[model samples]
Target: MSSQQQEKYEESELYRIRHSAAHIMAQAVMEMFEPGEAQIAIGPPIEDGFYYDFDLPRPLTPEDLVAIEKRMRQIIAGQHKFEKKAVSAEEAKAMFADQPYKIELIEGLETGGVDEYGEPLDEKPEISFYSHDAFTDLCRGPHVEHTGKINPSAIKLLHIAGAYWRGDEKRPMLQRIYGTAWKNKDELEAHLGRLEEAKKRDHRRLGKELDLFSVSPDVGSGLILWHPKGALVRHLAEEFCKDEHLANGYDFVYSPHIGRGQLWEKSGHLKWYQENMYSPLDIEGNEYYLKPMNCPFHIEIFKSRVRSYRDLPMRFAEWGTVYRYERSGVLHGLMRVRGFTQDDAHLFCREDQMPEEIDRVLDFCLHLLRGFGMNEFKAYLSTRDPQKSAGDTQRWDDATEALRAALDRVGLDYEVDEGGAAFYGPKIDLKMIDALGREWQLSTIQFDFNLPERFELIYIGEDGERRQPYMIHRALLGSMERFMGVLIEHYGGAFPLWLAPVQAIVIPIADRHIPYAEEVAARMEAAGLRVEVDARGDRMNAKIRDAQNQKIPFMLVVGDHEVENNVVAPRLRSEERLDALRVEDLIGRMQKDIEDRM
Candidate 1:
């Protein structure tokens, strides 16, 4: 979610309605168990809806959710006023003596440093309770005035999922009830429709159906194994982006997978990003670590020799694969993988050329994404945090302004996220909005002064004076794995003609037509199309249906009529058909589609 949208949601009336609904849900779930039999963990309103955690006597079933939801409606109809009460930690504990979870939360509040979620707080807060419908919960709430404020008809219980207490694995696993609450049934239906579409376009599901990629426990989690077709699509994407980078004055470079521990220490990754790094390897009695990023390696190349001012704006680009440890719980298909290749680049320019370099990089980022048919973007400018930043404050401020000015020059919609930058520098993050109106972070251009100082990078000017060079870091597509995942969902597995893994599939009408289908496929292959012949002996309609499911851009049907005319009848994935054409004419038409990137 965008920052503006988040702020709006937090203050909206719907947020309050959902908040109260969560409490109602908790009350209903607790009522399911006998007195003191069930334990309530936490219930909170989240984006789009709310969820509540519980340690029930037995695992919850769909039937139980239905019963709880039905009872919640009755409670809401009772119109119970939500009343709040403040109490001392001792009194709060005494009141919920049997509720061990609430007692633990009260102790945290009493300790004076953290909230109920175990996140740090600036100061101790007063313990409060909100009661309604004959049940009370420890909370700091902005709930609706009465239970009637919530439209029970607009609420739904989504599903049950297991969650660890306070996100700690060692803690007891609680059953979390996910649900959504809207103001009315119309809005609820629309949200549910979007969710249904999202499920259909889910990359993980599409990955299996399309035979694109897979993740196996035997191969380890968060590691993607790209099948032949998936690899071809990825290669075409990288090939196109690489050519663009070269045309834009970027020099491609390669770096090793592991580096000495001192390299990461100097880059501040060891100091700041150590948790994401794996345990070091001992090579020749020296500690070495997997490269979590390509920045340090690129910087080493910059310092390989003394550069001149004439070489001020040197752009180094790489399709470097890096690995970072991601927990098993968060390991998602392609989207949240541990091993991935980044479209990483670094720019070394003099101070005088920094602003222009920033502008060029932003323009280039858009150009690359647009090449993939992604046009909508939301830009976020993240400024440095005072407590965690390196380099001079003035330099940081100047770099931040440069980023802001670039965004302004481009007239792109953006938001300011204060004190959200990396410890090294201020950066501009570009998130591409997909077809479903979901934003995916794909491109970024960051200004870094810390790396140069840490690495002591310098260049000689015309005046024969050695001066430090300004460094700009960027990742156009972020990572190939995540980018492909977003692309798959954005297009819903029906890729554009140019990027389609199987551009065209040939379906023969009968066994006798198989020979001609192979001949037609060979002719199309000679014309530079990714073509394949389907001679599985299935009926013509089944072949067409299967081809459509595979998202093949074009399906060529060959039979006596087509072969006698020395042409192959072409059918598009959209079920649009065109007159049979000669092989040369077909090639021309398909070439036109590829040229337009349709």
Candidate 2:
């Protein structure tokens, strides 16, 4: 598609609202500061919000946000008309004389207008500008017709942060203001409310409260310190993944954290993934690199043994932990980390086996996600970036067509990401929408024609000839850290009975009932449930509150009356169900829940 067509496609209703909101935000910032003091850099619309970078002597504060937001409301209330104008290169440069960023943008546009043959077109597309009242900005048109047409109550300032100009750290730092705009007042309110609830359910906050994990600045960024509780959860998740993979005919394998640099070279990772990889270290006169991906190692395992066609579809799975050098600024809590364990696997299959192997992986992925109680999903069929790709046309076509066929065969409707695939191959990414309506990328099934060819992977065909095998790389849980983050948010920290770090907490009202609480805990543990006894010398209400705060799914409150009747009061996290039940009966149900992995 043409660039203009791409722009048109990108401009959705929400995009227009956010784009117009950016202009309004810039106008607000300009008006809030003293007349010639405020210098604007760039204001762009992002997902669900608008942010503008600014150059100012004084750093903006919370109070400044309020003042600027107030001015924005005033502008919107004034109902100023937005006018669009087209001008020549000279006229555009003159209009943007004081705006360095705008001048740069216009110059780039002029250069783009030149033909490849070195002759500029006679009818060059004119530079466009949008004007609302006294504030004007160089922009492509398609904004709201009038400021008054916007819902005054539907826009809000979210936060302020420092960002480098054009995202380059070497450039001058600019203060960035973020805000969200919605179609209506109600939607805006709902969006803000969700944000607030999300904050309450943030895994980072819960991690601290529950003593789960922490990130220390002293330890460097993007490195996680998994506390005891967090480690227990991680262990459970990994075990669950291992069991699922085993049931799906996968052979478990272990690979080293670091491999010889030659291995990555053979797999083509050294060339394509060098930026994300750690610097190589020399060991005994040989250079070695930490593995960025587990695929190359698994492929080495496959190629170790000369395989007949019977072992063609060799499925190798591993909870391989690897490290990647993510941009420091992009790291946030455990969701984005430098070191993580990927539930990675690769199936070396013959050409004819690709479809069935992919189908099996998809089924296993669905079942695993369902086991974790994630039912809602969004699938993307990501194809090659046609403009910048290393593979030949035939291989790209074959890989992309294979993915298309799989999706079609399953009758799964997925959106196509025009150029979202990795440089190596086409892939399918599954993003699960949690109960909170947040999307998390959890599963990926990717095809790699480049790796097998680069590694010269081979399998004996039916005709007794050596032929290249197709490789499939799959990661059901993108990473343990991120998946745990999503799981915490999915269940709001009250994990399912089987997955909860502490499935049941036995609470004794007083010291007298502590013995009975121990008995109940023992019975629960015997039934294969994770149980803890709260024997603190605190009151019953305090203990109950503590359990609730920890988000324990069930709190078995034991007291004298319960001991007399040989029963316990089962209190749920929601406080909706508090019923007296026979201890054995509840134990039976808990055992069933654990056994079923529900």
Report the number of backbone clashes for model 1. Answer: 0
Residue-wise lDDT of candidate 2 within 332-433, one digit each (tens)? 677789998999999888878877887788878888888888877799999989876765677678878877887787777899998988887889999876
Query: What lDDT is reached at residue 496 by model 2?
Result: 78
Cα lDDT of model 2 overall? 0.84
Number of the top candidate by TM-score?
Answer: 2
The TM-score values for the models, in the order shown, are 0.86, 0.86
Q: Give each model's whole-structure lDDT.
A: 0.91, 0.84
Score residue 581 of candidate 1 by CA lDDT. 85
Which 10 consecutive residues of model 1 have the lowest summed lDDT?
Answer: 432-441
> Root-mean-square deviation of each candidate, in angstroms?
4.4, 5.1
User: What TM-score should be assigned to candidate 1?
Assistant: 0.86
Q: Number of clashing residue pairs in every model?
A: 0, 0
Q: Report the error of model 2 at residue 572, Å.
A: 0.9
